[model samples]
Target: MKDFLPVLKILLRFVIVYIVLVLLYQFYLNEYENDVVDPFTRWVAQQVAFLQSIFGFPTVLVDSLKLHSILFQTEGRFTTRMVEGCNVISVVILFSAFVFAFYKGAKTFLYVLAGLVILHILNVLRIVMLNIIFIKYPQYERVGHDYIFPAIVYGGVVVLWLIWIQFFALKKTDKS
Candidate 1:
């Protein structure tokens, strides 16, 4: 029982935080009625479209009814859709839960804030990259979107977690 205490604490904290954040997310979703683009999703689509335009690709983001997404279309054809999940809130929740559970000091807040910003930028870039890839090679859509791209985003979260543990969490744990 004593040996399991540390693991138990981390698990409990993670579960509690996850539940709370998910509940809040549910409330947010409820505020936007059916067949509507929530602000976050719309923002992500806008960011992707902006990037595409910057890269010399004419893009338009439109609220999609049938798919419940902010679809990004290039060359007057649908390229990809920025749905709720593409906003990366779920990944941020997981990252936050882990870091908060093992937080050491004031730096914990800063680390989480910086991590979220980086994660958001990475997510936007990921979408843009996927859009270009899929448009150029339509056959690779499944492999890129489902496998390669997700690995990059989640892999970034893992890297941030490792950095936190090494620089902050582990040092504090050793001192205590």
Candidate 2:
């Protein structure tokens, strides 16, 4: 029984943190009108559009609230849309939960903060790349959206967790 206690504690922490963050996010979504895009998603879409525009695409961002997503248009032609899933909030919540579960010290919060920012920026780049793919090679949209981008985002989270465990969570070895 004693051996299982630590594992159980970590599990509980993970579950509790995950559930609380998800509930908070759901509440945030509920506070917004269904016809309007939620603020976080809107912010992510804006970042994606800005980056695309920087690439000379002249991207147009449209908050098609009725559709529950932000639309991207280039030169009056619709390119793609960014749904709530593209916002990376869910991933952020998950990453945070994991970090909180295996929390090491005061520095853990800083790691979490840095992870969130890194994931946010990576997601923006992913969306911008997806938009370009959708515009240029519509046929590969499925492969890119469903497989490639998800790998990039989730794989990044895994790497961050591994790094945290290796450096922050683990006590350093004696080096004489």
Candidate 3:
């Protein structure tokens, strides 16, 4: 019983933190009416547009109040739309919950903060590249959006988790 308690505690903490963060995110979403786009998603869309522009795509972020979405258009053609999921807050929440679940010390915040910043940057770049994919290769757009790009973002999160585990989170069971 004693041996299993630690695992159970970590699992419990993970679940609790995950739930709380999800609920708080939901609360943030609920504040915006159906006709409005939330600020965070809009900010992400701006970042995507900014990157695309820097890449010489001449991008414009068009937010439709009625539809509550921001469209990424290049060369006066729609390349992609920024929905709530594209904002990367959910990914940040997931990463944070994991870091907190394995709470060791104050460094947990540093790891989570660094992870989130990287994830946000990664997502913006993902959208910019995905926009190019949508523009240049229409057929692969679905594959990139559904599979390839997501792998990149999640792969980054995994790398952060690994770094945390490798340096800051030595397990109690490890003799070394």
Candidate 4:
């Protein structure tokens, strides 16, 4: 019991931090939805228009969901809302904190950052491809949204986490 006290303290600290972050994110998301989501969504629609014009493709922005507006283009659609918790930045921050808490070094930090960037870019591309798919075959929208897209986005995150754990965390221990 005595030896476990330090470990318990660490776990408690992590829980407190995680809870605070979650609450803050929820508050921010609520405020953002009320104030900024629509305008930002309109801006995204404009960008889609410009991109469609440039690429010579048709794009549609749909308000099917509540949290964020979905943009549908010949290539793909993504949400325009830059809500802090909805996008990759939040993922990066959370994962970086977790990794840093466990690994504790500059190299680990950089790896996490790189992974986060990769995940974000992939997410953007995924949205584009899904939009294209949705436009080409409207019937597939349900399948794409419910299964394919979530798998791609969340699966990408999982892969990134594994890479970080294996190459960054485990590899160093193996070498030592």
State how far residue 142 of model 2 sits from its true place (Å). 0.9
Q: How many clashes in each structure?
A: 0, 0, 0, 3
lDDT of 3 by residue, 1-176 (tens): 99999889888988999999999999999987574478889888888888888888989888777667888889889988988888888988888888888898888888888898899999989999999999989999999999999998999989988888777876554666
Off by over 4 Å in 4: 1-17, 36-94, 173-176
What is each predicted model's overall lDDT from 0 to 1? 0.88, 0.88, 0.87, 0.59
lDDT of 1 at 15: 88
Superposed model 1: Cα runs more than 4 Å off: 172-176
| Per-residue lDDT over 79-167 for candidate 1, one digit per residue giving the tens place of the 0 to 100 score | 88888888999999899889988856688889999999999999999999999987898999999999999998999999999998888
**TM-score of the candidate numbered 4?**
0.64
> What TM-score does prediction 2 earn?
0.94
Models sorted by lDDT, best on top: 2, 1, 3, 4
10 residues in a row with least lDDT, candidate 4:
79-88
Model 3 TM-score relative to the real fold: 0.93
Cα lDDT for residue 71, candidate 3: 83
Comparing 2 and 4 by TM-score, which wins? 2
Pick by lDDT: 1 or 4, better one: 1
Which pairs of residues clash in candidate 3, taking residues 3 or more apart in a chain or in different chains?
A: none
Clashes by residue pair, model 4: 75-132, 76-131, 76-132
